[model samples]
Target: MNSSDAVDIATDALVVIAKISAPFLLVVLAIGLIVGLMQSVTQLQEPTLSFVPKLIGAAVVIALAGPWMLDELVGFAHELYQRTPQLLEG
Candidate 1:
């Protein structure tokens, strides 16, 4: 309703998004780094060698953390819905 309210909502949404995505992002980053190190050591320089592991790492993170991510998203949505009336009244 107000600029401050809108900003708060936007910030909360961004935080939810970051919380949901962080695990996958961190896992992929770590996997990529390790793969890069291995590639350098062996001088393989294969693209897929780097990509596949990162992809798999991301997928594994998603699979492991999917329920928690869903809970965070659902909680955020529920909070927003609960605030809708107050927001509208303003």
Candidate 2:
């Protein structure tokens, strides 16, 4: 494909990646912020304190959103596959 088609495809892939990752990223951000605040208030500067909670939060969010993530990925793959002929012909 030409440059524009390649750029469009790259943009679409990035968007799909962002959409799939946003939930987990957001959860991690929120948890980190909260943990930071708690650490500040309690003056507990344990480096490992945030690890488990963030991990657990990430896991929980992934677990909850796994199906939706899968659906989005599947849809993206399907769309890409459907566009293969046009992409190739470009």
TM-score for all models, in order of appearance: 0.95, 0.94
Give the alpha carbon lDDT tens digit for every residue of 39-84 in model 2. Answer: 9999999999999999999899889999999999999899989989
Q: How close is candidate 1 to the true structure, as a TM-score?
A: 0.95
Find the candidate with the highest lDDT and give its number: 2
Q: What local lDDT does model 2 show for residue 36?
A: 97
* Candidate 1 residue-wise lDDT, 1-90, digit = tens: 899999999999999999988898889889988989988999999888877787788788878898999999999999999999999999
Looking at model 1, which ten-residue stretch has the lowest summed lDDT?
47-56
Superposed model 2: Cα runs more than 4 Å off: none
* Best model per TM-score: 1
CA RMSD of each candidate after superposition: 0.8, 0.9
Stretches off by above 4 angstroms in model 1 are none
Candidate 2: C-alpha lDDT? 0.93
Local lDDT at 27 for model 1: 91
